[model samples]
Target chain A: MSLSVAMPDRRVRATAAVVVAAVLVVLSVVFACAVGAVHIPPGDVIDGLLDRSDPVTRQIVWQIRFPRALVAALVGANLGIAGVLLQGITRNPLGDPHILGFSAGAGVAAVGLLRVAPEVPLALVPAAAFGGALASAALVYALAWRGGISPVRFALAGVAVAALFTALSTALIATSKLFTQAALAFLAGGLYQRGWEHVHQVWPYTLVGGLIALIVADSLNVLALGDDVARGLGMRVERTRALLAALAAVLTGAAVAVVGLVAFVGLVVPHIARLLVGSDQRVVLPLSALLGALLLVLSDSIARVVVAPGEIPVGIITAIVGAPVLLILIRTRT
Target chain B: MRSSARRTTAILGTAVAAFALLLTACGTDETAVPTATASAQGTATAAATQAAPVGVTVTDLMGRKVTVAKTPTKIVTTSPSALEMLYAAGGTAIARSSTAAAPGIDTSKMTDIGSAYQPNFEAILKLQPDLVVADASAQAPLAGQFEAQLKGVPVVFVGAVKYADVATSIRMLGLVTGTAEKAKTSADAIDATAKQVGDAVKGKTATKTLVVVAGRDGQLSAALNDSFIGDMVKIAGAQNIAAELKQSGQVPGYATISLETAFKDNPDVLLVIVPGNTPGPSISSIVARTFPNLNAVKNKRVHEISLDIFLQAPGPRAADGLKELTTFIQPDVKLGAAVVPGY
Candidate 1:
């Protein structure tokens, strides 16, 4: 529907939204770095950033908060871009990374590895999750395939696969007495205790996934026009959709690997981006990334300070904050 | 239809009158013996002195008055901690929750009654336990269900997350099981060890400490001052860095805090509780990488503690846990044998 807007007007609106979102992302990162379980003054935060503050403040800012906030920003970007790509590929408004059961698949494998073969280094957990996510994605693709993918059939298959994966994840967590508490923390999805190691783990995936989504943005837009029209336009419709789905799976897997299954950010951020700018995939993708980063950083900061000392999972905060914003945007836009 | 309605009304009136008569009789009995109901805090401990062979009335952790009629020979404990306390009180369960395993307690022949959070009530009933011990926090909800289905069986909820409560739970179990003397002995051992550890570290500079409990899935959570391990640290003359962090009630006495807060606190010692049979890089290793200059890392004070004694089964062995904590907190001081109890 937003595609009917004049191209020039849409461009201006997208540019504005992108600029605002980017600014908010930067501000939210700074805010996240400043506030935490411990109180550090704004000047101290700046001084800590420059390595001029006291030892404790310096450690809190540099070692703890800075790495955590960066991880949150990168994860938000990954989930946001993944949401945009999946929604584009499926041509379904409800499409997001979780719609394809990526998070649940990743959760099952990651949790299983952690419980069953805990001797494996913590660093390999993301790989395990990524593998699980891709496996489930393959299954969804196979089930959805009837010579070519129809959007509704694909979505239905995805839902069925997601339910099956979720049940498997629950069973794994339930049967293993050892894994219950920590596995639950992972399943609830949070950036709790994330550090420089997590930042190092996720950034490469975000870069690769974001680039892929951008390179194929034009194809996404053409595909959005309907498959028959896309084929007539000389596009390889099935190949493009498959590539986009695979790309989204990678992005979603990366995000889930670090923070478990954070809900709402991937589901709602793309819609917000489209409502703000227009239905342009090129604009919606980057803007959604920016908005996703902004929303998560802010939500993470709230997660830190609201209960002060005890942290709420970042995923919980995202759902509480994202659902309302998406609803308001939808109401005002309609 | 009118005659049937009249007969139903007559029956309902008879039942109401009988219920009122029963209530008056109970009220009169209570009024005649005002001292029959025990005091709130020391109800169980006080009841232990009474040599009532037929029955004993006491208050449980949930504040419900429970009457254990006849010595409870058959018992079921729904949590590991509850099972430990029961054993410390010189009582044993015919069946135990699957997760209930503790030091010095044998469960090889006991029937597995499933998880404490949702036990198999039918299996428990099949065992026909005279007493059912449940955890106050985790198994509190099952109390109503147990009462409804167990007929005359006494379901006692006893969850001890702190050092003081550990002894209280043991004594409560002892009084109910008619093993009060053995229970008092174990309870006294806990108090003696606490004092021993406290006195040994009294003059030393209080070590700043942080306790990180690694979950089976490798998630790290801080043990607050109110947690069983956290309370032990305090008693061992150390300042818990995460003590001030408010518990959000996800897990009683534990909180998930950002590693940043931990970094800022910069404790002198780090104690990581690792569950038994877990194999991997200790949480201390992860902490080491994140903050290499942490005092605990720099000074070589990061220690891995056993999850079984400190957390999973916080019972008679808590005294041993305290002694272990002191070795890390103030390694120089050695307590005399007075604190050690023969269990």
Candidate 2:
């Protein structure tokens, strides 16, 4: 699985990985639109996509499956980028948004609002989640700051914050019991019953976070070469790290707000991308985006049809599919 | 996203308030549902002169044939609905689940046996003497172990998920407790209520309805034609819009339906469950955001009903639930008295 490449050959390989992943994402979305509790023929799927299908098929494909698939892909891509940024800034191979308790923070706020004051309009949920995620990131940074932030200490603080927030989220669910199903669905992470509204909600974060990730890639690349060397290279080490962590938090928050806490995409997709395209942030970031979209879209498709009518959470599918694939890639790479 | 997202055991544990009422044509027969049948072996008058006490053989909800070899004086009920049936049948349990509450029964004196899903087995055994009545879906899995732990005490599983199951459960408990006459009176009340509701709404065109059990964050699961609430909706002359949907996984009678299906079905009346203490999103607001064109939104027929009356246990208050449904389904039809329970 390890492709030993010459310096010039690495660029071609990374481009190929990105293209292949992009193609897989499109194919998975099309496949997803074609199959569901109600079976739509390939012709009908295409017609539905083009807004020329019969009323029923159009409703199922355009209104239900299409938007849901897009939401899953967007969430996946955002989380994957977040993972790369977090891992890069922390210099920890195991870093992801969840490791920093970003999802937990967001989950607590969103679940609490839904449980306690369910009358709150649906539009406000994403904003609350975003606020909670940023607040938790700030808390972790403050705890880690003795003189300045240390990567190990920052990561440790994130885990503690995440545990605390996760407990609070659970407490809300157990105590309220009214929205247990809704809270559980969100916590478990899925694109169930999602429509264009969720797609509209998530895409802005993807666009902004992605642009920021691209802009900060070189700084991340510099920071990877040890903190002292990065400083010697005229990179503002602490500021860059904080900026990247905040970017990761925004991305994680957006994804959680829309689809809840989908696991593995943030944690595993970046690793898979690094294995395929090497550690250069510029290459890893885009490659991770494509790979993440492919992974989530494919997993969500499987989630929709595996049990049919009734769906398992997309998170479960991601973990079941992601862990084995990552293991095989790691085993072969070594 | 609703019931299907949950593991079978988790759904059964939490949503055990109702199970499949009757195997509907759409697809409830998928689960191995054992119908409850109580056979009183020998006439009540003949047992008066007999030397031995009269025993009754009853097929419980789990398909287990339990023989009550004498009237159970020290009975323990695990679920709230089971306790309701037991109490209605004139049987007083020595211990009851913490959630068990009947209309007039003062459960303050009874020993609490924890939740219906996870009863304190040790506590139950400490107070138990003769028999244990448990919910079929939630606690039936523990029956073999429980009976073994109790050393020959029979555990009769009763799940009143459907409207009719309430009567069946009461009758079974009546026979077990030697209070068949009292059980008949209570059980007949439910039938009379259903008949009255049906007769009131008979001439009117059936209203198309969508009964949703709201999960947090606007996630909704619909009650199909086979659910306890679904039975009431049918009796009240409303055609359940989710009837065509099949049961998903182990969530016996309810199915997770997509919003598109809901929008397409275009139910005339949309009933949302508002669980206690949480004044969930107004149906008008929800409709405006999601499905403005829906008839329910246009007609202002989207109502938020009590979860206890509509979604929870189908116990002694089942008749009350029927009367409540009739008011919603056919507004012109008036009952003699208000049916809302105080609790």
Candidate 3:
């Protein structure tokens, strides 16, 4: 194994990767803001930012493009860290927030609420989704526990729970005729037409989740060493795993709450981060967040322009790009 | 072994061909024709002329040629837009699919035949409609199911995706309903309205417009070329920012554009078309609060229009839709205000 080899240079590599990723995230935000269905010259984009003299340009920058791009970066950061936490806790490379069925649980509860109460105030629907995700996470945790949770058992339970929750959500959609179009689109996972109200909704959870992940960063590093080793090292492995998973659920729930479900970001971003820097959770976590933010912001920007005035699903763009990046990583690693 | 496998393949091919033939032979044209005797609530308006049936060989929007024994007495529209077109053509139906409750049409006596996209074949058949019409442009994949359900009933599809298609489809509906004269009157009225819009903006400079449909899902998508609203925007003498984009999948001439691109295009006129019963702050608020620099918002030109006029059977009141678009895009051009149809 290259673990011993990778260990020595990891600190330096991680620091370098972090700087590179941070730079990329900032650049992605700028790129997204400057380009859209409407074209503003790069100078005007910069001028719109610093000068604010051109009313139209200023509005496009500050009001529309800026908020959208900012929200995208924020969402990326949320999903990115969530991916790191979930993957670390489960010791499953394929693991992400959905490993706890957060998305499906959020979907079921959101659909049920939408069907039962046609008017659950648009601003507050994310709360309903967050509630659903927590509930599903609880369910997955309860079922996966047999004295203590193993990664395989927990993942299988999560998959099953996700399936059940997804089915229940679809059943609600199928049976309810009064569900609004927004209600359905909310479940499809895109930031299309999302604005500041959405930004307001996701901000608290992102702050809380990101901070929690940072505080628990050392715990995650200990937990990544198998449970026996972690326990021997005086770490409360089960409790730490639970806390990390819960934090991931919160982050995933928050992301899903705002954009419904953006595919591949949470699943792909962490591994890509680890591949860029070594497998040190401390380094990988922030790197994942930056990479996730950069990837989504850039993908969203492309989603806006690829068809010009028309936009395709952002998930499609991410998957198209994400799958290839992941495949290359797998082949090169193999 | 290979010969035996070949023999099985030949047998299976024969069976498939036989099945196809059987499906084709399941019903004859005579059985598909609805009886002219009993007319439904809306169809009775045509009863005065239905007593003497006339046969017309007409090609539908999908290019399927259909022969009608007489004007259909019982009619069902699967989509809201088609129902609107049917009403505008001065025809009525005995039943409609679930989402067909548009303004002005009375659905109290109409049976709900499921949804326009997945209409209940049994319910549609129970009505014994002489003719069934659906929006082919919206649900072309469902066409075969309707055709397969035909015991003798002729199912016609209309592509009411544009202002022109609305008038053409209305004229076709007139042909199917023995209301050709009535259809002509309504079509001419719509055409006259178009002429009015054209005349008002005859020599005016067109505005570069962006029409984004605010979906019920809180999504904003660009209304592209050939779309109902896209076409209306063009006829009103405005340049569509999403112009030249081809129709895609189920959405036809619309594509989801990011808010950045939408704002970047900086349309002179921006129209947000909300395609649902409930209106939310997702779009209006975003445009007002988030894009203050947009020419539309800065000049107070970001207009929010309901789905009824935009999505209701394309072209039903398109002349009116065009008129409104013209006034917004070319304010100096004076076009008379038109009624907001039944909705």
lDDT per residue for candidate 3 within B91-118, as digits (tens), equals 8888776766665679998877665544
> Ten residues in a row with the worst lDDT in model 1 chain B?
B32-41
- Higher-TM-score candidate of 2 and 3: 2
Give the docking tier of candidate 1.
incorrect
| RMSD, one per candidate, in order | 24.7, 22.3, 24.5
DockQ, candidate 2, vs. native dimer: 0.02
Candidate 2 lDDT, tens digit per residue, A184-216?
767888876566667767777776677668767
lDDT of 1 by residue, A32-148 (tens): 888865667788888876668764565567656776787898899888988898888788888877867878788888878766754456567778888888888888889999999
- Candidate 2 chain B TM? 0.77
lDDT by residue (tens digit), candidate 2, B1-343: 2232123223222221121111011022321111111112133334542556566778987788877777788989888878877877778888787767766878888877676644655455546458888887556546654653444466788877678888788888788789998888887776677777877888889999999876544455788888888888998989998999866422457766566776687888988885445466564476667887788888888888766655655687778878877788888888867432222
Report the backbone clash tally of model 3. 21
> Once superposed on the true structure, which residue ranges of model 1 sit more than 4 Å away at CA?
A1-5, A118-120, B1-343
Off by over 4 Å in 3: A1-8, A51-53, A177-180, B1-343
Worst 10 residues of 3 chain A by lDDT: A174-183
Kindly indicate the candidate among 1 and 2 with the higher lDDT.
1
- Candidate 2 accuracy as lDDT: 0.74
Task: Work out candidate 1's RMSD over C-alphas.
Answer: 24.7
How big is the positional error of residue A116 in model 2, measured in Å on the Cα after superposition? 3.2
